[model samples]
Target: MSFTRCSLFSRQSSSDHSPSLLFTGLRWTFGAIALSLGAIAAVNTIITARTPPMGPRLNGLFGRYPARYGDLAYAIGGEGPPIVLVHSLDPGQSSASWRAVFDLLADDFTVYAFDWQGYGLSDPNPEGLNAREFGAQLRDFIRDIVGTKATVIAHGSAAPLVLEAAESGQINGLILVCPDGSAPDEPRQTERAEFLAQKEISDRLLEFPIIGTAVLNWWRSKPNLEREAHEFALWDKSQVENEARLWHVAAHQKGAQRAQKALLKGRFAAPWRELWKNSSTPALLVWGRHARGFESASEWGALRPDASLQVVENALLMPQLDAPQEFAGFVSEWVKKHTE
Candidate 1:
């Protein structure tokens, strides 16, 4: 589907500028940004098509879901309270995001997790999908598909959206895995700046139509994609196979890009604060010992009334992948105690 090119969305300016002039200027800027993104998309597609596929297994998992805006392709399995898992920024994090938890909880709660807009089998958002918007979409999907009052389990940047949904009082419980929005206790000056830079790039790219498309397309390549996966899994650069998995997600799903842009721009911050302040849902926050969000969870939980924090003994960003059995058992027990 072709989308109209436009500049990054602009909040109304308080300037005394005339409406017509403002509108006209904004339109031109938007158009230029859109064209740029489109050109990038074309180039990315060309490069991706030339690259090899990850063979049959990866292709099979690349699927779609028919939602109001469009179809969202995701991975679904297991059965009980509906548990939707939202993955983090790491590539190849689709079904893999829920692997540890799914195996453990499938028998008890009906598990339903999907790659947000662009990561898994979900389609790309040519029109741009914001984090705040995705949160609303996810809430609606949970109410409509999984039924309201179900549990939400999310990780990384997706935690903000889930938090928003829970704050709406619709979610029964929440499980956050290495959530990203909290203010860390020991901030790294260089690392924080690097994250800021990447986010800026993601935000700028989203506005440029061709560039957005190209990035997604290149993202779908085996080598390029694998690199993403390795980074997400926090592995060494030599993990070619892992990187491919990450790329496969970008190639087939569009939501990932939209979600990425939203997170980068601090879109989820408001909702995150709202949920933490107002909600009564039982929350279990799990973080890796070495994860960026680890300290944030501990400090945040200490101040909250109904929240619990768990720091894995020795792990990275993905505790489930690093310590599956233990992670699964912890989650299962927590869910049982809270739900019952």
Candidate 2:
């Protein structure tokens, strides 16, 4: 009706459409939420897919309190006497750390390789990450799982647990490989304390929410894995190329960051030297000639003359991985001599 044009019939400006703007804003917000949820779902799916299967590998869970993250994953194979191969407490390490020597040892004695709690396929417990607890776990594992007094071969920081088990008469024999300690006169105590302090700080930082994930992703990057493999694990770069993928995958497993955080915080470290000194069990100390720490094997030998010392030539920290045949040979002979 042109007779009197109503105000409602007037042309409205773009600014007048507040309701439309609000609707559009709501749609965008919901879209963003959906996209975020989808991304999270995808990531979870990938993690689930990448998780390794236990398979028919004779792996089993053992511990007294299974519900309290006391379930430990272990693999057993071969025949004859039992020999448990315990891996180091280094970041990203697990039962897989002994893969290079597992089959070789399995050829002779019944070999057991296990992931410490929170590492590899084992359960995680933030509160149970300490040396005494770990030592108890080993003792229980031997008593319950192996069903016999088994010989223990422990590496790096894992040395303490075996040593403690030996002290408690839970194990038949003990072997320490590139253990974490220095000679009495060496000025390593202060250095070790400072290093542990830094590691504790780093571990705490890695426990943060988003930042922890980001930092761990960076820490487990391909380049870093390659560097660690060559500089620390292996003498040859070709060996790194072969094992880097396995290490990378192991480092990315669920709870791996938490495990590494627990270890780096020195939770598994104890008065290991005192334990070693007091241990009555027959022990074999296997050292890599080029290993950085424990340079004074001769000095330690003087203190614990009962323990035998053997240095693997041309090997760094991991003689088992670098020179599996020789390491296995030494182990076989030592086990035979001691077990007899």
Candidate 3:
């Protein structure tokens, strides 16, 4: 009887402790992984910073301009009401996204497109890109560089930055292509705080050094870039055929991971739809005809009855890239209406 009681008690105690032991084991395992990645990330970043970049450095249509985070690479052309083209987010993309339509629009408007810091042709910042800083940069660019209130055409992740930049009041109008979300009129501060908190933890880990950078390089690798292009970015894969190879070069630049790390930390994100809704500035929302599972322009119209929405034919993810002429026409007409 005594032995039986002792055995039963021992079994119960072991069972009770197993779950906590498992959790501790998992925490240690992840900690080891974090350390490994951090070491590798630091080495990679240092090597990149020390050496000159290899093969075909990124170039802008015009040249670099003095901007907040670093010297921003920009291109300006044409002779009418000024328009600024802000590229999609991430280290992989830059003003190059506008190449297809830039010249077309330049015919009528003084079109300007530039690489934000930590991106193509722009100097890399060790601290990485932050959404608010980008917003402030855009604001300054418009005030000092652009020199006038103009139409801002932004795509994908860049849309939110545009909204941020618009807060300072240099914007006469906006065109958001395939914007990320429909923001609520009221700020969802609680949800944002929680989300940011979660990301901050990860961001801290990524800010370490080598391992984090390695992970980012893995993500920005050519294969991954191609995969994203086919799976989500482009509705038509052929458009990527003649694409510039500079992004591959750009991704490996020293401190490239800083931008990726900041992005992962959620520093570059914003409530774009909400910002657009509240801006009271004249605005247009555009979508690719085949924008896979996104809110339809009509659905968006119903949500913001005051706003205008348009759909370009035979495009997805990137309406302006796939259908530049149609996208250009939208810009020309909208600017005409708002400015006239």
Candidate 4:
């Protein structure tokens, strides 16, 4: 009886201790995870602080104007009818998107290209910027700098901003390449939060601070950029090796995450369908046949009977980079037709 009692007491003691041990283990596990994240953030912050800027510069920086919101940087050269090129908005996109078309159009028309606020050469916007702010910047550029009617060309998500800014007679001609119509056309409201939860994990990570900057740097790393350029936007990724290198430089600029955070937060995209449909400005719409997530040219074309649509066979999202000569030709011919 004494031996059995001793054995039962021992069993009860171990059972009592097991819960405490498990609770201790859980605390240690959570503590380790928190420590690891903090260490990673600290390392990344140091690396970011030490890293110097990089570039394959856009050649000419026409000016930097202090606007009401963020500062501006634009390049201008060649002389004729004014033409403005607005680069697509991606996490790290800059005016580098226009290297080919900018030079080509410069020969026949005075060409302008700008780094959007929070991107290359332009002042970074740390408070975060949205399309409404971007539209204001573009409008001021047209009203103050261009100082006259001009033809505006925009790529991808930059279209809505341009479309909204091209107030009656401010832009006589508009050319949009692969403009995003994926957002709902039901309401014209921008700055919507409807798309926030739908973003990918990588994009959502861009909203955080040190960790976000680290994630943006990783995304902008040369190899990942090459893969993104290869698989989605560019038809000839090998040809844009220099552009990819330049883009890597632009993407790593300090405070680049501000606009990117806005981009991922659904601030840069909205339903441009009705806005696009309502525009009276003479327009040319182009799409790459291989583009992954956009509607067919025919679908977008149905909205505007007066507009011309072309689906280029050997291009993807960025025909400007892929087929510069051909894209410039399209613009040149179309503008001439409108001018004549």
Model 1: how far residue 107 lies from native, Å: 2.1
Superposition TM-score, candidate 3 onto the true structure? 0.77
Of 1 and 4, the candidate ranking higher by lDDT: 4
Candidate 4 deviant stretches above 4 angstroms: 1-23, 46-56, 126-128, 184-207, 214-218
Q: What is the C-alpha RMSD of each candidate to the true structure, in Å?
A: 12.3, 10.4, 6.2, 5.7
lDDT scores of the candidates, listed in order: 0.63, 0.74, 0.73, 0.76
- Candidate 4 lDDT, tens digit per residue, 158-270? 98888778754688899989887555444334634544334556565665665776666676677887777778888886766765666666776787767766775667765
Q: Of the candidates shown, which would achieve the greatest lDDT relative to the real structure?
A: 4
The order by descending lDDT is: 4, 2, 3, 1
Clashing pairs in 4: none
Candidate 1 residue-wise lDDT, 8-104, digit = tens: 2244354644576669888999999888767766676665465443321221133456666665555555667667777765444555556556757
Worst 10 residues of 1 by lDDT: 53-62
lDDT of 3 at 19: 68
Error of 1 at 85 (Å): 1.6
Worst 10 residues of 2 by lDDT: 55-64
Candidate whose TM-score is highest: 4
lDDT (0-100) at residue 108 of candidate 3?
88
**Which structure is stronger by TM-score: 2 or 4?**
4
Please provide, for model 3 over 153-236, each residue's C-alpha lDDT reduced to its tens digit, 9 standing for 90 to 100: 888777778888888878988888887643324438768877667667777767555556676767776777776666666777
Residue 95 error, candidate 1, Å: 3.6
